[model samples]
Target: MEQLLASDALSDSGKIMLGGAVVGLIFGYCAQQSRFCLRSACIEFWGGQLGPKLAVWLAVFGTALLATQALLANGGLNPQDVRQLATVGSLSGAIVGGLLFGVGMILARGCASRLLVLSATGNARALIAGLVVTVAAQASLSGVLSPLREALNRLWVVGPSTRDMAQHLPDGTGLALGVGCVALAGALAWRNRVAVRTTATAAGVGLAVGLGWAFTAALSRVSFEPVTVGSVTFTGPSADTLMALIVRPDVVPSFGIGLVPGVFAGSLAATLVHREFRLQGFDAGTGTVRYLVGAVLMGFGGMAAGGCAVGAGVTGGSVLSLTAWVALLSMWIGAGAAGLLLERAEAIGRRETAQL
Candidate 1:
């Protein structure tokens, strides 16, 4: 990496963007192949059917945790330099925003990353929903909705000292936590009889997360200009990518800017190779308004929370960010609640139809 950066072939920012693209490609391919999705995982958990969906999610999460912690333990990466730990965070935002994001993902039938993958596979509905999410996210970031997001963020704040979970834990406890999660995930996967190929792909997703961290951290260390050290995340990247396309055509290349296209390309390649590419649109069973509303909520909620499911949940959680963990738990709770409400509503509709 040092050797490559020393060469004048590309600018530092360009190289960072390329690294991001590589990580995003791996993430996209693995996520697509494994069908890794938090929304599915949440539903499976809440529905009391810990099947392949939940197993896949666990595999991704556990592996990500283990790999990231291993990197930190070995001094391959510095936790203090990372944004999730280095800066102040909002507990209130994590709770409220996570809940909103969870409910939104449920309504949209997918989270930000899932929607992007689906869009690449020619899912028109997902494509539209993703656009809406980007628009809403942009609005929350700097437009009208920014005020509301700011207000919520101010409700409860924590400093860098408290934000980093590693600071409070006993020495090596982070590594132990990672190991325990991996063991649990392995056991669950075995119990569920998840396929070996599926498990491998899921692990690949986790690998991508680790690689993302390593790439950025390494780049930041060597770069003359300041570079943010981050891993795989979709919400902020999606919004940034969209804005670059429409608002700032000449925007300088960044990691997030490259990540969006990389994921799309990887997903497209996977779907094409597997013969899974199919054009899909909205049907009567899938209402448009629900998806639109969900996209809006996800946009605002993700911004408010500082990241999306894969963003804060897997990436941030892997690094042991307090707010990220809180956000992840809140997401689960919100998703479970939303799922139950949806089920009841469907049941009521069925009964009413029968009576009529």
Candidate 2:
């Protein structure tokens, strides 16, 4: 469909941006309605309830895998052209950085995508966290923290060809992974449906993610100018959007750029329709401190990992990328550990209060 649009009156960039915005809108609406958060999913998984949110996430990720791989099989997208982030240093980065990102997400009470949705619905804390994440991301990428990033790269970065999943896997592996994962996730989600509305919302979110990949892949194939062959991932795009706003006027609007704002717009619209829109802020200084630190850690950690939860976990993992799998697993472990720590602390505090 996007290939057919190549000759349309709109420029290639415009088409790309349009596709991104539409996908973002769909995702935002679904996420807001479903309360989809990867951190929450990890915590819930740890708690032993296959929560609706986790089911939704698996379904969403699996949907992306199936959709994207189908495109690759049909030659609609080139695996070579896909954004591959595997490197020698990535192993350490994904584990260490993913842990940091997971912990920060717990502190902030949301990941990058969830924060954007929260900000749209007039959550002041989320707004502040978003701003901090944007700045911290900039600092890590090119500002003060670049040296630290460079040091890590020099010390731990692996050769590019070492962990490339596509190269090592056989011809039919990508297809098998995608199909099997999606089918299994969808079946489990269906069996566990607690509410019809939540189930529908989860399915919608999954479809939106798949469509996002399809849209980008199609555009990349047809565009004459350089187009990023990627789908929905928030960290780099959030940082890039911030930089574009403040310093770089020359930066052209890409799919990620359009997608970020579209998420806000879509979430806002959904909240209004659902009557869930309300101004919210921190109730305590402790929360404020936690969010501040979390934002900083997330900014640096996300960049180090080469992606955030959604970026590496869903989009990259769709193609069975090794770096993404490692990062995703690391994030799960990190979030699980953080959740346990928090729970233990809360339990101790309760005991202390009872004794007092």
For TM-score, the strongest prediction is 1
Per-model TM-score versus the true fold: 0.98, 0.91
RMSD of each: 1.2, 2.3
Per-model C-alpha lDDT, please?
A: 0.91, 0.79
Candidate 2 Cα outliers beyond 4 Å, as residue runs: 1-4, 85-89, 249-251
Per-residue lDDT of 16-124 in model 2, one digit per residue for the tens? 8777888889888988887778977888799998766677777667667777777777887676666653335367777777888888898888888889989989899
lDDT of 1 by residue, 84-139 (tens): 99999999999999999999999999999999999999999999999999999999
Clashing pairs in 2: 88-157, 88-158, 89-156, 89-157, 89-158
Model 1 TM-score is 0.98
